[model samples]
Target: MNMHNTSSPVTSKPEELVPSRYALKIGDIDVMVVSDGVLPLPTAMLAHNVDPSARAAWLKEMFLPPDAFDWALNAVVVRSGSQTILVDAGLGFDPDLHLPRAGQLIKRLEAAGIDLSSVTDVVLTHMHMDHVGGLLVDGVKERLRKDLRIHVAAAEVKFWDAPDFSHVSMPPGFPDALRSAAKRFVKEYGSQLRQFDEEHEVAPGVVVRRTGGHTPGHSVVRVASGGDRLMFAGDAVFAVGFEHPEWYNGFEHDPEEAARVRVQLFKELVETKGLLVATHLPFPSVGRVAADGDAFRWVPVFWDY
Candidate 1:
């Protein structure tokens, strides 16, 4: 047998090896989770307040690398009646960070047959670069509809005005990068912002609600229709959060409050039995929460092929 199949057919176009988008329905509404790609970060970003050995043990339990790992970055697109809402844009190109794997949202959206012009509104969960940088990508704004309404917590925009980095524990250069991204985003698209005080319905069943924690204006989007429900939790919850609800993510501006919000959201999920899709959770992050002793358990929904 030949060592190499030199005669194999070659195609002009190559497709991705794995699926990047997963679509599901919540009653009458349609939701699709699109992966922007992954960000490799120090494991210490997971919980700054915990002991190194404890964190290492958790990593061991999960069979993950103890030092650093790739964090999944997800963005959601929701369709309700006549409105198309984009939630939490993924990390858009940051050359200085040398994170070339991330910031693939725009192209991924195109691959998924989602057009920027079709988006009528944008519901931002927070002002973090990973959550809003996609909008700042070159040519993105020009492609968006002129009347596009970007819904966000008024508090979020205000917080970025004079952001407080004293509490966060991110890796070096993160704070400055985040600050620059937020400032540039505001300067570029300030006119389109639709700042809301507490909660606002983007469409018939899609409501964005503020639950300040990770950031002063960090929020979550709740989608409900008929009898089905789902929530797109921004950074309030992480993969480690379900088991270690008290652990503080390095990105959280107020770690204590973020922990509280995570537990509270878990209780709410347990009570309502709503599907959970968070920004930092594994790809296609659809799941339900169950009370497991004093902690919580992540019950991922079966893939609906």
Candidate 2:
């Protein structure tokens, strides 16, 4: 877990807060791990199925604080030839949210010398605010990019679009805001929206596979070229999810389904030895999931690049 330090051009009293971004190669595609910021959640908000005491003990064993966990808001950028594809834009600019560490994705992308308009495709893993928020400009309803095609799970769009569809897993009264966001997203990008039902290819080397349960149509993106392969596992597994695929987060729409998908995806990754780019493992979350007995472990990539 030797995370690389990608510097931020800002200063503070003790030390400068650095924003992280990393680049790696997946066959012919050039992939960049960009950060939006870190989202901290109380440990009490984590486990929905497991006993609280047991979960807390495990956290303590891992040398983590008994109170909170810092989850990274990471997004991926994939470039092949002339095409630039973005996976799950981070939390958009929202001053009201008061999440100081989040909402830095666009700034990090710009700092990396990536042109905002050059992004040709936006492949949304799910319609979570943390993921799709960056699609809109700072506090504005307008889209950040007008020409890029937006791809999302058909099931996801249908689930969020239904008037009667109430999200049970979110905090009380939060579902309304989420539903409104989804509708706004649809209204803004419906003309450019491309929805897929099952495993479908977005580009020559990029494929989206449905791994539902986190959301109705949550997906994992697979990018393959030559003999190299990489999996952009969007919200399928967090760092702890690797060791306890059976234990699901409170936000999981269907905990059982999410666990099932996690186990299956982890096994497949172990068998294939594919590089995993997770959204919430650690900052610049690129790693490999290996079988640890019946469970799994995250062996993060150690490249300095």
Candidate 3:
């Protein structure tokens, strides 16, 4: 399978770095940011949590698409020695969903030299559709391997799997699906599924940071090798200028907290000068955060495939 170079600013397909796929090396670990598909929200839907005037002004300046915002779905796969770890599973090939660019993750993994059977662990930062949709495959359940262990934050588990989650005012048709998916995973993983708190080590050279607020337990991935670092900022920021440290999606479950978490994450990125990966910020979705005056901008790592 082939992928369009979502990271290419030149508007042409990029060269294949993994020979047959997409894999970037930081040091000892191989990081592959794979696509799940795209999720398009009507312009009206995005205006949910922000003031209409502010939203209007921002859209006009950015020259956004007609009547909608397209969010790219992606997940990161990390390989260390023989350990294969998947950051998040994307939306599987769901034909019913006409996301022109959706559901191609497993194929991308294959191109990157990763086999689903080889994945030992799957870490879910949250239960959002874009992040968790790839968990469930056709005949098999959400299990990556026969015994793949699924890891998630305890709060994340509680939020989606909770019986009373319906009481909360979420997007019109989302609460039901979220709850349904949570239950399905619970049944599939059984004892192989587990949960952690705020910060914990999910795998070698990987630390899970609980950067909540987007959802109850939204988290981010921090990876380090030979003292070099990379932060996989999940659904924390939108691609079109959400790089201003505090600029975050209004859909965030806890907007104020999301802003605080993004600022803190940006601070860490600045101090470390580490590579950064954003799930929704374009494709080949890895870049660096740099201070532009008081705000921040994403400097895409062009060298990465």
Give the per-residue lDDT of model 3 (tens digit) for 78-190. 87666778898876644544665666677677655566788888888787666666666675454356778788888887776554432234445566565666677667665
- Per-residue lDDT tens digits for candidate 1, residues 1-305, read 11111122445765666668888889988888899899999999998899999999999999999999999999999988888899988899889999998998999888777889999999999999998999988889999999999999999999999999998899999999999999999999899999999999889999999999999899999999989999999899999999999999999999999999999999999999999999889898999999999999999999876
Which digits, one per residue and each the tens of the lDDT, describe model 2 over residues 1-305? 11123344554562325646787777778888888888777675467567889889889888888888778888998886777899998877556555687878877777777767778888999987788888775543243567778888899988786733332344444466566667777887788988999877888899887888888889989999888989988888877787788887766777788889889999999999999988887877778888899899999888664
Q: List the residue pairs that clash in candidate 1.
A: none
Residue 100 of model 2 has an lDDT of 80
Model 1 residue 296 CA deviation (Å) reads: 0.2
Superposed model 1: Cα runs more than 4 Å off:
1-13
Best by lDDT: 1
Total clashes, candidate 1? 0
TM-score of each: 0.95, 0.89, 0.83
Better of 1 and 3 by TM-score: 1
**Cα TM-score of candidate 2:** 0.89
Query: Which has the greatest TM-score?
Result: 1
